[model samples]
Target: MQIYNFSKDNGKKIGIFNSNFIMSRIIETNKGAHIGCMYLEENGIIGYHQATIPQLLLILDGEGYVCDEKKEYFKVRSGDSIFWEKNEWHETKTETGLTAIVIESEELNPSLYMPKKHWDVSSVSF
Candidate 1:
């Protein structure tokens, strides 16, 4: 097991995240899993884009808005958890700023090792 303290280390700048924000990577496992903390200052935004892997977002502080491709949006506050599947289009903005922890995969198709089903559960299939 590995441990990290984001507050002790200065975070690296990445991608098209709002210039005023910071995304600090805490750990990147050999399995391609990534854990990071993000700080978005008031009015900071993460623009619309489709993800290539499954992701779980954990909001740690403050409040914000998260949106889908349809342009519909929802408010999220601290302690909220949001999940987005591969290729899901989404965006985030903090009108009053917020901090969140992002957990995702580095590889485009990392394995979560789900168990194979013995019985088919599809409603449309026989």
Candidate 2:
């Protein structure tokens, strides 16, 4: 089994317009699992994006609002976990700096359900 230290992982900026959000890949497929950590600055927005595999977001600190294509929103904070279905459009609104761990499967194939032209952010691969 592979292990990862999220605190030691260096986060990289993946978005073109908003660079305040940082993402660090903790574990990769080569390690037998996929995991990562995301840190969003206060007022930072990740914009609409979707993933290939269903993911679980476990909030570690601060608070934020998660929204999807339906415009539905949910308040999240430390100890809260949210599950995002594959191919669903989603975004985040962080009121305070938000830190979270995201777990997904690398074995799953990903397809962008949303049009590329509609994406205001950039996609980063680990």
Q: Which number leads on lDDT?
A: 1
Output the worst ten-in-a-row residue range by lDDT, candidate 2: 109-118
Error of 1 at 76 (Å): 0.3
Candidate 2: segments with Cα more than 4 A from true spot: 1-32, 106-126
Which residue pairs clash in candidate 2? none
TM-score of candidate 2 versus the correct structure, residues matched by position: 0.56
* Model 1 Cα lDDT, one tens digit per residue, 28-105: 355667778999999988888897776766667887877666656666676455666788888888889999988887
Query: What's the lDDT for all of these models?
Result: 0.61, 0.58
Q: Please estimate how well model 2 matches the true structure, expressed as its whole-model Cα lDDT.
A: 0.58
lDDT of 2 by residue, 29-118 (tens): 433446799999988777878856666566788888777656666666664556566787777778678988777864422221111112
